[model samples]
Target chain A: MKTVLSIGVVLGAFYLLWMAAVPVMNIKWEVSQAQRAGVEVWLPESGIRAAGNWQLLSENLHLAAGTYAQEKPRLPSPVQVFAELWETTVEKKITSKRSLIFHAQVTLSATLLGFAMGTALGVVLAVGIVHLRVLDASVMPWAIASQTIPILAIAPMIIVVMNSVGITGLVPKAIISAYLSFFPVVVGMVKGLRSPDAMQMDLLRTYSASAGQVFWKLRLPAALPFLFPSLKVGIAAALVGAIVGELPTGAVAGLGARLLAGSYYGQTIQIWSALFGAAIVAACLVGLIGFAQTVVLRRMGMAR
Target chain B: MRANLNASKSASWAKDLNMIQPVIEANRLNLTFQTNDGPVHALKDVDLEIEKGDFVSFIGPSGCGKTTFLRVMADLEKPTSGTITVNGVSPEEARKSRAYGYVFQAAGLYPWRTIGGNIRLPLEIMGLSKSEQAERVARVLDLVELSGFEKKFPWQLSGGMQQRASIARALAFDADILLMDEPFGALDEIVRDRLNEQLLDLWARTGKTIGFVTHSIPEAVYLSTKIVVMSPRPGRITDIIESPLPKDRPLDIRDTPEFIAVAHRVREGLRAGHGDEV
Candidate 1:
């Protein structure tokens, strides 16, 4: 309850601040540009009618136009942005105005797919590397080194390489997410798999159980407590990878494309909205993985 | 079928009622480890035999190779030179045949599994069906007086209960021989005494041959039919004392003069092994 209230107050404050600041920032830019003689800028006045929702919040926050203020800003006010979100999200085809939701879906698809692939590959590699000394000595160093190269540098190269090889769209973005996200899963799972002590192994051995039985019964369950936390980290990393994958390519739809379109068209509202959407989506994805971990572990009788 | 059952019953019955071959026989068993310091002879040429239904124990100071001897018989360590036979088969063969079970000093229960799950582990490994495993688990839990603790994890249970669960694990597979390396050595006196009494009842009911290791003289005398006192620093057996106590179930065996006499002899054997005159 405390967290929810705090978050509401903070988000509310940010909205009000953004409402006042956007017009002021826009009006100043307009005047500077007007003086420069190169272009004209649009900015709303500081009055109750011009500030809009700031007018509704209180008179103390009311903004009257400064001497430098010009026409209304192109970007919507805070109330207008919320109205846009409500209209576009629930009523109108939101993405039709360069469709923010469609782009989010595109990025989300790549993020989810890449997260799945990366997590699967990472867990498999972790299990192999943890169990086998040869794999640890040979494969692990290279797997770790694979992550040292910056993802931004790798993103375009990945797109270019995939483009040359007839792969494009979601696959390229997912590959990028997988590339960035695999390391955390491997490291976390390796630690978890090795968590069982020698005595536990001997107990299994004394039962005359096979190596496979020991792993399935003992090591696998032991690894779970460590695995889920890493999965959350990996999923968030995967989303970042998807977004970064978008910046390089000339994609028409995705959170990245919406960001690019907003920047190009000077639609700061669209960019901020897309950024917020991306963050919320990433949080939800990570949260979903945690929920799955809880459910699966609870079913296995290891709720803690 | 009835005749075969009678024969099988008599086979185990031979240990108690008839002069039969020992259930476990270790002849001149020697083990030397290649250590950084030097080749340490962990076990000297040790000869021992344990009859079926024998509650035999090996008691000595630490580094006495009592544990090494147990490990040799369990086939956990390859002896430098030795021959160990359990139920007429070599130690290796007996291990492959799953003819014996082992318990370490600690409970050694899997932490992630429930107490009941730990007991069923060996049975599961041995490929028993689910129903058979369940039935055997219940029986063994009853044997250890842990019938209601089936679903509790090892950490949730008291140390004594966890140790009893481990005992259940050893007995679950129905192995004829049980090798215990000071199982009750870590428990408090009260819990240890309770476990010792229950262990005797288990031995009486199941007829499993037990070879235990402990430092407690009274515990050794209370539990074992024969106590093997050992001297350390390249361990050698100093004395093997046999008990002549009554076989009837009585909880006050410790207070009896006869039990006291047996315990006194065991103490003397231990003292002599420590190089003090008994």
Candidate 2:
């Protein structure tokens, strides 16, 4: 217990140091933008955006919350913005039915569906290219080329095309997610399937195992290490793709929609909060995938 | 030496060892491989017969078609002009029925599978029941002296241990014949000697017919009841030496005059097969 406590204190000190640096860093980037916008010198000569009360970490404390800091150059304190985080997430429910949690649930549903569809398609294509000689010859070149085409430019086109064809709402965004997510999986799985040496393949042939048996017994299991890292990348890409799809078409309810409103109305705090929210969401999803990787491999007795 | 097989053709091949009745008969076997430059004849008019429970080794120089012969028996490559029979059935028919096990120069183990799982692979493919597969795996693992390494990955083990695991895998399904191509070729000399002794012990205990291909003459002489010597660049069998050394061999047998004599004979046979003066 004492050892744990000591380590925790060290980590606490590091976090405090980090938070102390963050307000300045955030303001510096913002000030550069403000300067580019040709704003007059809004803050004091000291580059410190916080006035006098410069508490680094605690949400309850900051430069703006102090008395002497009132007349100095001002910026939103960590206290005020963090308080807004709690209010927007917990207290400010939409008719007590919808909040950040509800919005997260909605977005997660679409993201997961997209991830599943993307992974399945990727696996099928990889298997086709691996097993069918014609597909390997004809399809692989196009698959490589598809990844090079910018998905950001491609996402809007997909959304518009789907809208025209009478398929709209969640599907357009899901299609975009699949488009971005599958390439990594296909590439990873292909490398993995080919990873077995010639001797290993000969061993399978010696037993007269069918093609499917060779895949299930050898290739598929061997692909696991490559598959997991790619899934993490693919899931993150899926989230980014869903967000990009929202940008052009103007969807409501997702964090993307929240960003558009914030940017349009000059709600910098709200926009920042939404950006943080999206980061946290993506982190959680990737973390969940990592957790599953550990559990599944451990259960299969593949991992030590 | 089987100059006896060089039948005065026409009517004699039919009378030689009852012709079509041997367990494994390769008559006028030829395997041609087409490379970019031209067609290369890997095996030329090679003929041999292996009866039940015979331990045979094909030994020759580096470019000799010994390994090619083993590959042919496994039906991994089709012969250009010849017929091979495994128990009266064609090589392809026997392979489709999973009639034999093959061990390669490398262990060829899947790194993802543990030792036990690797051994269970052939059994799984043969569609044996779960309990049966596990039992057979345990039995063969014990046979190979790897009973405790069931859960260890191939990469975690030493090369010798991995090779032993592979040997266990081939034996786990109780296949009647084993086609091993330089199975201990990668091991250190000490390990190779140990595995050779163990392999002979295995052959004695199980009574499984073995067809091994090796470039080592002493190894072929030490383990085989019969050593077949071949030459390549026109791959054909030039000598078939029936070992007069007693079947129960030990490491100390190498120091004996008889073992040295057999080794001398194998070397001469290899040289003669390669068209070099012996």
Candidate 3:
């Protein structure tokens, strides 16, 4: 209850500040316009626009109200953004490409697919690195190095190469998501797989347990606590990758395409709504992983 | 030595005669660990023999090779140079045959598993029938007086009870030899004393060849039939005292004059090992 109240208070304060800033910035723009026309302007109140004369107070109020309702303000007020969100999401039909929900669904499918592939690749790589000294020496460095290249710089190339090979649609986007997500899982799993202390290892050795038995019975269970947190981070990164992926595909039908189309025509409210939509999707994905983590760790008695 | 070697190699007919052979024999055992600092001798020229059904305790200060020697018997560590035999075979061979169960200093129970599940781990790994595993788990839990608490997780139990569950886990596999490394070292003295009494009672009932490691003089003298005292800085056995106590002893036996005398001798041996450094 307290957390919800705190979040509400924060959002309320942010909206109030945004509402006040929009009107004040409009008056400041008016003052700048008057000064450019060689008409002296000054304000009695102390603020950034103190040089503006107070004679245009009624005109400034009308201009401020206009700024709040503008079709393309430099920064849309919170009410405008939310209204746009409601129209695009709740007001549109589910099947309509104009609906943010429809775009969100497209991005979500790619996110889930990429997250699954990334998790599998990460775990497999971690297991290989743990068991084989050769992989640890050779593959681990390359895995680390793979993350240093900018994904934006490489995303277009990946799409182009895949286009050349006629592998269009979702696969190339997922590969980028997997590329971003796998590194964290690999690093986390390696540490987790090695978390068992020397004494525990010695206990298993006394049983003369086979390597496969040791892995299944000990390392795998031990690594689970490490795997879930990495998965949460990976899912969020996958969402970001899916969105960025939509950009290079020439503004098709996802949230990334919405962002691209909004920016092309200076649709500020559209851009803000799309941004909030993407954020909501990322939050939902991360929250779902958190729910899974709690349930699993509780079942394992690893958490209270 | 030759007779013992032959007894190990000979067929089952030789075993029908009930041959006298050491269950664990170590001759000139040495282990040196190479660290960043230098080579530190963990065990040096350590020769020992443990007969069947004997309760042998290794006692010393920290860095003494008591735990090292037990680990060697478990094949958790290999001696730099030595000839040791467990159950008339190489340590590795005995280990592969699952010839012994080891209890660590900590309870080390898997928190995810209930007490019953933890005890079933070894039996499961050994590929026992489900009924057999259940039976053995029940039996050992009974042995440790933890029969009714099988469904409890390790964290739900007290420290002493958790350690007892670990002991039950070891006994579930029915190995003839048990190696314990200060299994009660973490508990308070009152709990430790009760556990010691319980352990002696269990040992008498089972008659398993047991090797125990400890740092306490009274603990070593109270529980062991043979106490090997060791010292640090090259870690060698300074003295081996054969206890004159009877086979069965109560908790009050520690108050006896003979128990005090044995403890005093152990303290002396430890002091001698330190060689005026203390």
Task: Tell me, by DockQ, which candidate is best.
Answer: 3
Tens-digit lDDT string for candidate 3 (B180-246): 9999999999999989999999999998989999998888899999999999988899999999999
- lDDT of each residue in A157-241, candidate 3, tens digit only: 8889988999887888888888889988999999999988998888888888889988988899899999999998999999988
Error of 1 at A180 (Å): 2.1
Question: Judged by TM-score, which candidate is best?
Answer: 3
Q: Counting only residues 3 or more apart in sequence or on different chains, how many pairs clash (N, Cα, C under 3 Å) in candidate 1?
A: 7
TM-score of each: 0.82, 0.81, 0.92
- Choose 1 or 2, whichever is better by DockQ: 2
Proportion of native contacts kept per candidate: 0.33, 0.58, 0.75
Give one digit per residue, the lDDT tens place, for model 2 in B13-32. 55564444666889999889
Q: Which ten residues in a row have the lowest lDDT in candidate 1 chain B?
A: B14-23
In candidate 3, stretches whose alpha carbon ends up further than 4 angstroms from where it belongs are: A24-62, B1-19, B276-278
Clashes of each: 7, 1, 5
Off by over 4 Å in 2: A1-87, A90-99, A164-166, B1-20, B151-157, B272-278
Error of 3 at B151 (Å): 2.0
What CAPRI grade goes to candidate 3?
medium
